[model samples]
Target chain A: MPDARSTPVTAAILVIGDEILSGRTKDKNIGYIAEYLTSSGIDLREVRVVPDVAEEIVAAVNALRARYTYLFTTGGIGPTHDDITADCVAQALGVGIDVDPRARAMLLERIKEADLNEARLRMARIPFGAELIENAVSKAPGFMIENVIVMAGVPAIMQSMLDAVAPRLRTGARVTAETIEAGNLPEGGYASDLALVAKAHPGVSIGSYPSMTPAGFRNQIVVRGRDGEAVAAARAAVEALVARLHAARG
Target chain B: MPDARSTPVTAAILVIGDEILSGRTKDKNIGYIAEYLTSSGIDLREVRVVPDVAEEIVAAVNALRARYTYLFTTGGIGPTHDDITADCVAQALGVGIDVDPRARAMLLERIKEADLNEARLRMARIPFGAELIENAVSKAPGFMIENVIVMAGVPAIMQSMLDAVAPRLRTGARVTAETIEAGNLPEGGYASDLALVAKAHPGVSIGSYPSMTPAGFRNQIVVRGRDGEAVAAARAAVEALVARLHAARG
Candidate 1:
């Protein structure tokens, strides 16, 4: 259990890969990262997916890090020429990047002496002054420096890295969520009324999710809040709206 | 099968919702749309998620529509105050927006006459010169103007709307795919050699998917090409690399 009163945490995700932009690979990372950060009580403000270009990576890294409390980057950290995250992070932070002795030693533990070639060595490069974030699944560790955490693009490795860093991250009050399923009712039919409910309860967030059914359109109005009482109050209002809708239909 | 030969089809997805930015909602629409476009031979070039703010929506809509062959927006099409996709699209195209008679007629057919209030009427609005893309599950149809298509963010509705519009879209030559799985090998260990292999196969796209098991990390390299022979050639090179990895380990 990490500290929940972590002075209001905020995070941004930078997804790196041309595959994402080209729609060759639909990114699964943004959703996973967003959910993880939110559950940890860290506000996830924005997500940007840049190509494999070094300049774009550096620019995005610099901009996101400057704006958010923590910046997490996924992808572009492989052993190929395209895998330039380590170097880009160094350039972004204006620090020297090289194969760190510590990282190299970790790599040595995993690979056979005969297999310790140039390609394998590429994974050992770390930005100066960065602390290694462990990858439990693989020996190739991710790194964190100046509030920016760089993890692998692959979901499994990224998850392992996130689990490793979770203990170290600061947290805040977790939000409580409640959903009221307004089945077969169009969201527009209740917009003004829901807006009033939202206004009446300033602390709670009211979101409507519309779903289409065999019969007609349906909406699930979700009320979220940090305070339990406030969330309950908002839920009650949503229930009232649903009851009214049923009555009118009847 | 649609004719995907004459015109090179392209699409950009605009995800709209404050919940997405606030991390309250994790967007799943992009992946679904990406997969859909690829199978249809429509190249999805860019994706941008903007907050439900009209200005941002207007700007993103204009930019993406100009750059891509088709622009698809998901979310903010519901009947809430935040659901302002219609108004924003109208503004983006510099056209008059109102409760169109056709859309209103559709809503009237779906909803009880007694419950058809002003709030419900909001869902009937469409931008001028826009053609309706039917939401088969729900009566409310998505609208398309020029190359811009405004559909619901809800996955089901979005999918339905896509099915409706997909038939009408001009597509291109379908890209074929091939895969070679290199079991229990870190991508770094094969990076340089694989880079050469990739360089040699210029027409094919070689993507490395790293998977983690209880034993170790495994990389699955997928080669995509327009020509079947090129795809097979790339797969042969990948198989050779996998064999080399095994021999090296022995």
Candidate 2:
């Protein structure tokens, strides 16, 4: 709790859409959000994908925002009838929502009058006391109420909106990563030795990712730590284990 | 609902772990589950990833299982202290759980006596009325109780278990997909025209995906339907629309 490794900023992602659930659309937002959050030094700790149901959306928003330092949501902010993220966010916060002048002004720039019907009007509503997160490509803006940042779910639009919002987030000390590729060893074979290395380096995180290569299944042990010295120490231990594994194989 | 679509078998995926949320792990499970369920003719209508918390997992299981035909969970069934999915699943169903004779018999095949301690005993706990799903790579068998299929979080193991389970599931009529790539067009520009096409194809689902190619941004229109003939008709209309778009650009 001493903030020695910088203030740890934890965040969550809420993806709302029926398309994702139906398998009609494969999600590309989670990866982009994860990469963006990591590079910005915010630890993204949780993500939930719920349907357009107002009750479910409200529940997820309340739960995630309470737990994480920042809650980022994508999807359900479109002009379609199924798009209900705006109203859901408003209800979750127990605040009145209407077409904010700032939001309406922004939408009017890209959308024509006839195109902007009552259905389109739904996208302009923001919770009271919320700050609009600018959408660069499309005029419809995402809004941030307290710790929750509500953004569009479309990958292109979401990326554009994230570009406009990421600069404003509070960042912690960046966690650096190093990987050691251990060839052709099943995770079970190295499980005991790896466990010992993990216990020794308490400050570092060691993850075993078994990947299928052209040669066959190769396990890559990744060591991550805020302290470079601890990470190096863990990496050395992993290398020694890998050498022993090779000798045993021979 | 009539049995016209072959009984509409529905399934939900519960992704467990803090790593996925923290962006340390980009989840490959949901996509694999979605694709696998669709291929097996099971309608995967929902997916949720909860943390290593008991209350959250119990609530999700209760809600999703009641609404869907089947529920599949990945992650948290490991030997570590954070691994608590098996116990939570048992608690959710209000069933008596201990190391089932069969489960213990299977685990004993691969793991040694010293390795299978009190901590590892947690993995062997199977709820009442549960049946084991075979894990070809490792001895830790996945369990199926009621409508929920508890599989490993690792992609390879999950895939193998899914392959084993697919044959046993009651399948509906297989849904078919068709794509019409619209080269270099923005989604908003063709919004009105696409709406007309969507209206025409009432039975088919038409989605416009905006993508970046070597030439720049392009829109790929996809048509999905249960009827092959209906999907082809929708695809033809989309192709015409894309052609008109190209001519207009020229």
Candidate 3:
């Protein structure tokens, strides 16, 4: 059996909302969570954005939860009618959901007793046997059931929830990355050589990314791996290839 | 049978890139395509971002293609070794892929024949039975096979390819949206009333979006539907509810 420390921990993110699908709101959470997970030693393998339909949310929750070590979802955890993530998660997990005393207390921090109507209480709904994740920005807590961690859609609130829940997660070896700038050096010039470097390094992943700037196509070759030495070796090879191409051009 | 014209046209976006999954590149194509599809009368149903791993790419392509009316993929169509989207799409659809003469001609517009080495020639590879989608910014063409449209990852190139392909697609009734700004009035105050309004308007989708501004929480209630009359009616109801809440506060 492989050592527990060597086994990779992977995750998937589910972003739920109709606004994101309609392009009314550009998603800020997916990228933020991806970077956060990368830095935290959790590999973000996949991301899906689904609308606020119950079946879609429930199906995605079940599918993703079974596939990854952790499934983190953002959105639809508010007081409004469309905020149905908690119930959907409960349904997905086959667990009963009710107003949790802990979550209610958290909500009470921001809302007055008289104002804690049915609508506000919706924010306090937690699945059975789930643990509440604290929110620093807003008091309505996010929750974790099984491997799924649900959080708010708002970026600030989501960031806070992530911070609260991150410490409890099982993390793998941190993947280190080295970026080699191949500025103005056309991808075609180094594509074949980079392919060879990538093939030689079995442990690392090498990618050539080209973005169009006002000046022209700015290219970046990135080498990444769980092993720092592998990443550095592949990065060095890529650098050498770029240098060779530059010299040949001269 | 339902009217063919009234039947909703749906799409899913499959973003194939390690850069996006690793958070090295923040995805700009998903939002751009989402808004474009909304305007073009196609409901953007789901989105998935997967790494450049061939199996993952093939699985996502097959699943999304089978589920939605159309599936659009971005990234991995470049000249580099990691640019394996074409081969993956071909494998998913069970079709043969090769360097197409048409695509070669298109590439020739931008690249000299002498410089069209094996790496550069990789850009000309197309699935056997796919129609090329034109890229105005960069000449290497995208392609459409059956219901799946494969485009470049670069935002500008993807936009141009989308523009080229949009005219040929069968579109549904364009969904219209009206935004009612619910300034400063707390969501808790109007949540219940808004739920009733949503229930009353069966034809429209009502979503209350709250964003944190420097000043405070700025809320917008959006009413969206294919029927303009239904959308307008829901918008009016929401407007009245907001007014009532403001009057009560005053």
Candidate 4:
């Protein structure tokens, strides 16, 4: 393969579930996968949460898989009828799906053959030519077909599957980040100067985040880029700006 | 207006910020909005999180606006250079955007005239022919153009803006949800039966969510529908199934 650091790797996450849309379940997988990908040198560009409708799942899988280097999907891969992600992926890729021997073996590790009824066998269904991703928690393996990686909705299983698949992925240069505490200095006081510094530094992305606290507003400015030197330069500029504003107020 | 009970109002949330995508910030809005809309008689059907890039924001705005009854957006409305959501929404709607007198007046409530520099004025920019959504927490306002409701990224301000705009929105019948705990009941034991219950109740959507607990798996079956009777019936069926499984285990 080409040098991992020289290429750009991007990813998108598709969360498939009605529970999330109904607010019956709060999604914990998206943020976990995003942080995991970022630390692994892959940039997560977008995320979409769609209901467990087959058509919607297929469309999202096709769209995201085509747009990014990899598409990671969580949810809708269980034993119930609502778990249609595998069928949707098969339909999206125009491939056949059936109970894979490898996946069935994984399921057998946790379940007896007599108890593996039709509903349980559903967990063994994988699209043709897809590789099974180990779920160390549940033993119901996730799968990867082409650029799409399908994982379980349960956080522990999803994390285990991600760890199982991470080593095989192509990664770009890891992005470095620096956070500057803007504290009580309002963004309005420094936005103009920050814009100039941002314009001067083309590659780095700088963001100002403000949150409400019991005391007042607490603000943080983060600078990030694949080039460590560029990130450091932007951080210094932001630090200088904050110090100058603080001195003026004093 | 048509009878609110007879109509189905659907919405999509478009979160615009690179901080969320980079995993620097975990989103607190999607779940809050989902629950808010669910209780307010609006169905939140989809959610998309995109970066601060202009084209991506514009495309997402246009696409979601066309597909849903209401498209709600958060983030990128601040004074900094990355705050380009207003411009992108204007471009998406093919409308002109500039500093609105009404919004500037709102800002003047919190900012003195001498301190209202160019950067602060950026927050006052609003698209033409749009109504302002008040932000009680911060004086800078969000706006609504057609079906799209733009709000601030901060949780407190976004909640305020959502409350301000909720009165004007056309809502459908409220969806009622019922959750049944399936303690120690493996999904494989009841997936088939639950599928039957789901099929029998056509209008209701049923989902089984299993999460790993310190001791074992804790699963919940959620039944949701706009019709109270349907939701209750599905919930009863799920409850009976769980009880039957528990008895068999004993």
Per-model TM against the reference:
0.86, 0.77, 0.98, 0.98
* Candidate 1 C-alpha lDDT tens digits along A184-247: 7657667888989989998877888766567755678888767889999999989999899878
Lowest-scoring 10 consecutive residues by lDDT in candidate 1 chain B?
B1-10
Error of 4 at A143 (Å): 0.9
Minimum summed lDDT over a 10-residue window in model 2 chain B is located at B208-217
Q: Kindly list the per-residue Cα lDDT of model 1 for residues B93-202, writing each as its tens digit.
A: 99999989999888877778787777777788999899999987667789899999999887887889999988887778877777688887667777888889989988
Docking class of 1: acceptable
Taken over the whole model, the C-alpha lDDT of each candidate is 0.82, 0.80, 0.94, 0.93
Q: Give the backbone clash total of model 1.
A: 2
Better of 1 and 4 by lDDT: 4
After superposing candidate 1, which stretches have Cα over 4 Å from the reference? A1-8, A18-27, A50-59, A91-95, A167-173, A183-188, A212-218, A226-232, A247-250, B1-9, B18-26, B227-232, B247-250
Instruction: Give the per-residue lDDT of model 4 (tens digit) for B1-250.
Output: 7877678999999999998888888998999999999999999999999999999999999889999999999999999999999999999999999999999999999999999999999999999999999999988999999999999999999999999999999899988888899988999989999999999999888989898889999888888888898888888888998999999999
Off by over 4 Å in 2: A1-7, A112-117, A227-229, B1-9, B38-41, B51-68, B76-129, B136-140, B170-250
Q: How high is the lDDT of residue B120 in model 2?
A: 56
Report the TM-score of chain B alone for all candidates.
0.94, 0.94, 0.98, 0.98
Better DockQ candidate (3, 4): 3
Worst 10 residues of 4 chain B by lDDT: B1-10
What is the RMSD, in Å, between candidate 1 and the native fold over all Cα? 3.9
Residues A197-248, model 2: lDDT tens digits: 9899999877765555667667677887788999999999999999998898
